[model samples]
Target: MADHAAARTTRSMTVPLVAFVAGAVVAVLLGVLGRVHDPTLSGTTDLGFRTVIEMKVVLATVIGALVVLQLLSALWLYGHLGRRPPSWLGTAHRVSGGLALLLTVFVGYSCLWALGLEVGTLPHGEPVPLRAVVHGVLGCAVFGAVVVKIVAVRARRAPGWFLPVAGGLLFTLLLVVVLTSAAWYVAARGWPGPAGY
Candidate 1:
């Protein structure tokens, strides 16, 4: 019985551990690639915005809201907040999560395709802004974390505690991403529509 229990425990950990390694490798490779590649500057088709940055900002903002909804819904679904989750709550959680992931991919692609990694000083020799550096690191980390979370979530036999932890990590990473990028842009530029539009 003890032997069986030990084997089960080991098996349970195998998937998550593999996932962690994969995530780490992906993050490193992406950062390396971003450093080597020259940005297109033209950006992945701006989707209808005047510029890629504008489109990226808008998509990121929407994804931020969806992420917020995902966190709340997950909490509610797990009975971490309030009463029992409604029947439709599961659907809402899944939909919001899917949408957030989808939009995140778009913003990430735009960043990589157009801007690449944030490094070096400006033309005037001013250092790259600290927020940009932070945002760039977190942006790379996001995809890795998301992969781990998704893998953990799908692993039915994994430890019960892993899903929540993975979700929370992803949540925190995304919140910082939004704050440093979209929120920072809006804060610095005083909202896109007010002046730009």
Candidate 2:
């Protein structure tokens, strides 16, 4: 009986252990990629910078909301909400998660293509703002967390908590990215670039 109990504990930990290693690898790889990857600058738009910023902000906000829904759905599926989950709960979770991922991919590509990793508009000698630096770091982290979440979800051996943990981390990183960039842009330049300025 004792041997069986020990084996079960070991088995349960195997997935969590794998998840931890994968998460670490993901974070490092994403950071390196963000640093070394050159901006494509292929995203063409007749609209001005302010317009682009506004559109990105709107999309990000929507994505963030969807992520919240995803979290709730995950909780429901996991029975963490302390109630019976609806039949559609799983479908809702999957759909919202997919939508969020798709939107994030588009926004992330556009951002890197247009803005690169550099922080501010100041001259070369000027110091980079702390907010920009934080945003950039967190941006890379967002990619890592999302990848980790995906891997965890697909890992059949992984523990159920692994998915929720990874998803939560991704959501947090995304919120920081949105807050540091889009929210800051809106605050600095209003919703639409101060009306033709």
Candidate 3:
């Protein structure tokens, strides 16, 4: 009987073990993908201010806004807000989370397809600036962070604090991704006008 009980405990530990392994696999895959050269959008360039990059920036801004909502909704759900959460709060969190994920997929693909993965190197030209490198690194980190968060969600045996820590990490990585890319784009290019680069 004691042996059977010990076996059950061992099985339960597998949930977190699997989650950690999965997250590591995801991070490694992303790292490998970042090194592959995608020539699809190598020659593509828009002279207008409303370029694809500009659009990505706008989309990232929206995602950042949604993250704010995610945080608020999460706090409410967890009773950290010091007030009763509305019945719809949970639904709001789910919808926002889904939307954020979809938008992130779109933006991430757009970046990789349009600009491979380099910091100093141009999409097809010489090195432009250091911000590009920072942006590329942060973008990859975002993927890894997302994988970690998903693992935390699925790991039933994970500590109560793990979810929140994972959530915070995802949020921080996302914010850095936006700041390094979209925000930098806007700073270099005037609104609705093509960049002078």
- Quick one: best lDDT, which candidate? 1
Model 1: pairs clashing at backbone N, Cα or C within 3 Å: none
Model 1: how far residue 25 lies from native, Å: 1.3
Clashing pairs in 2: none
Write one digit per residue (lDDT tens) for candidate 3, span 1-197.
Answer: 99998887777666556765676676666656766856365554443435777768888888989988998899989999999999988988989998998899788877777776775556588886677777777787777777878877777766566788779988988888888876776787745444664
Residue 65, model 2: lDDT of 89
Per-candidate clashes come to 0, 0, 1
lDDT for position 185 in model 2: 77
Better of 2 and 3 by TM-score: 3
Best by TM-score: 1
lDDT of each residue in 50-108, candidate 1, tens digit only: 77887778888898899889988998998899799999999889888988998888888
TM-scores of the candidates in the order shown:
0.92, 0.78, 0.79
Itemize residue pairs with steric clashes in candidate 3.
119-133
The Cα local distance difference test for each model comes to 0.85, 0.75, 0.76
Cα lDDT for residue 42, candidate 3: 54
Q: Model 2, 20-58: lDDT tens per residue?
A: 677677656655665566766566342454455566777
* Cα distance off (Å), candidate 2, residue 107: 1.4
Q: Rank the candidates by TM-score, best first.
A: 1, 3, 2
Q: How far off is residue 20 in model 1, in Å?
A: 0.7
